[model samples]
Target: MAFAENIKKIFTLPDLRNRILITIGILILIRVFAHIPLPGVDLENLKEFFAKNQIFGLLNMFSGGAMQNFSIIMMGVGPYITASIVMTLLPHVIPQLDALSKEGEAGQRKINQYTRFLTVPLAAFQALAMIKLLSAGGISGQQIITGDFTGGNLIIALITITAGTMLLMWLGEIISENGIGNGVSLIITLGIVAGIPSQVRNTLAVITGEGGVDTGQLLSFVFFA
Candidate 1:
């Protein structure tokens, strides 16, 4: 088929092949990072909380189970995304940003630099909020953190998560420079796709009356689907 020939041609070109390989390698690395849990958290309680809370469950799904695992990259480039959105909108409200936006590539780079800087504090804030929320105990009344939530543990977790976000941001930029598509979009897409299998299994369990999934909840899920 013509489509098959085009696909074959893509691999035949050394430059394109290398780019594709690099993208795949980085994606694998990201997924591996997602499995490495952050220290001091009660993973079982965390998983139960996410399972019971629809909102957080959805967020976990979007993060490809990273949130449920409480991984170092649990935030999953979310702060970077927020920072980028803020930067994009600020140009409309702030005269300085508006001027920079009109100056083309160099100006765009400056805005991007600013976005990266903003991501740091945003990530830290979000990390702290999540820590507090989990420690405070959700509807389940079970603390997700096993021990004390303050002091050294809090600081270490905050720094690790913030660093993880920055690392992901850097990886995305690398993909943009060397790979085939928008790096951040690809990372998000990959996360969503990676979550599909578990989602499918859960749906099947609900439909089969397994896992003690309530019939009414299944109906609601079906309606949402």
Candidate 2:
């Protein structure tokens, strides 16, 4: 069969079609979560800062633009990804971890559980760091965090962001179990792809505007490519 016909035949199989649909539905859920903001954020200030900061612009892309909105899952799968990486490397560095890793499914489950525990602290640390960075005069200047940062409110913010990371980790695991492809990879891919329209719009704006073209930015793009 031709490639297109093979694809059609694959989808015609009810099982494969259902799995694909479920995967798509789960991805949609992730996008929805990316828009649900955490409390007390000055979204307009955040957006303005993100527009001006290239580093933040890249962060927003990787985070499904969740960071731009200060969404609950603004940290994206970063903590989980970091934890997984650490665990993967630990097996090579620690003899005990190496031994456990060789014990099959139960051992892998234990490693995963440990990784999950590690993610909590990592998420909390990342959230606090992000909050401080955004509140500092140089990054956002406009006090995107709002209110005081030294009391119960600070704790609340940490907990909220950590919880969001855990929630995303759980959702990704579900996708791995019930859907198609590597769930975490698919999530990140969607986040990056989500910025396409805005990128095209900005490129067009730069091309058509009365202002002279930004040669530096053009050169940077060329070098990056």
Candidate 3:
């Protein structure tokens, strides 16, 4: 009915249809990037580590499991998001930034450029911190991060991950300019949705395995949802 008609109407508009297709294509590209792993990672240990740590598990969820895979896109849009937040708050704290924001489209474009520039250092810092955390006997108490932190390997990894974040940010900007939806938000939403099937399977396993049915757990999930 109404939903079907709305969908049909959307497809009937050529521009809208094309935009939707382009968005889907961009999302697929992001997922592909999420599978492209960085070097010097112990994949098996990383997986085991993610399974045991709640904080890492949540981080993996945000990155669409890219962190578990040690993917190049492991940071996802995190640095970009952080940059955006900083920009949003800067206007309140800095009078110059507030004035720049009042300059309309030209002002907004400058602000966006600043955000992009800021994302790089943020991404680098996050990458280094993640490496240190994974290697400091925190993640699964195993050496998931096996590279020499003091050597070129760490530098290379940091550069690769930061570049990955920048690439994702570029893709998101392109999607926002040419495709449907708020591109960055859509990308984040896709990452969250992508992990649902595996979560469902895990829930099923908990019910069918030695634990049997946990009605309280099931109810809590529903309530939380």
Candidate 4:
């Protein structure tokens, strides 16, 4: 079969089709949500924020463009990972948790619940830190929300961001249950896959442009071909 026929055969398998579609949707959501900035991040202030921060480079890789957008999801999964780390240390500090882990499936379930419960504050604090850091870097309070980082807006904003992360986390779970493959892993994979077509197109564009591939590259392409 030709390449298209192979693709058609893959999608014709119902499970594979659903998995592909689910993957596509999650990727779309990731792309779209990351662009939705929190009320407070000043797009104008980014140049200054990036000026002195090593974190921006790291955040860019993890958050894609979310941090640059100052999105509610700008914290990405950093807090979740942190919470997991803390949970790992819990057994060493707390005897009760250490005992609980001995309880098997039930214990593991409780641990997961604890991790999730901890994730809220973890996410909130992470969000706050990111906001303050970026703001101090040069973003105006006004840009964070147009006006007033009042007590209410701060809580609301925190809740909004926390909830957004939780929702993404939940969608990942649903995808795992209803869709094929591991949901969380697929969501992460989606980011890399999402960038592929465009990169390929860009490469092709360059290849077809004036001078295009040099003799060596063309020869290499043919050799590999």
lDDT of 1 by residue, 10-56 (tens): 99999999999999999999999999998777788787676656567
RMSD of 4: 8.0
What is the per-residue lDDT of model 2 for residues 1-225, given as tens digits with 9 covering 90 to 100? Answer: 599999999899998888788889988998898899877778877775665555666677678789878888899899999999999999998999999999999999999999999999999999899888877754545566664666898898889889999988887887788878688888888887875444434334545677545454333334333
- How displaced is residue 146 in candidate 4, in Å? 7.7
**Each prediction's TM-score against the native?**
0.89, 0.84, 0.86, 0.72
Candidate 4 steric clashes: 4
- Quickly count the clashes in candidate 3: 0
Residue by residue across 62-143, what tens digits does model 4's lDDT show? 4655666666666666666678789989998999999998999999889978988898998988887765554444333333
> RMSD, each candidate, Å?
2.5, 3.1, 3.2, 8.0
TM-score of 1: 0.89
Tens-digit lDDT track of model 3 for 139-167: 44666767676678788889999999999
**All candidates in order of lDDT, best leading:** 1, 3, 2, 4
Candidate closer to the true structure by TM-score (higher is better), 1 or 3: 1
Tell me the number of clashing residue pairs for each predicted model: 0, 0, 0, 4
RMSD of 3: 3.2
lDDT of 3: 0.81
Please state the error at residue 30 of candidate 1 in Å. Answer: 0.3
Better of 1 and 4 by lDDT: 1
* Clashing pairs for predicted structure model 1, backbone only: none
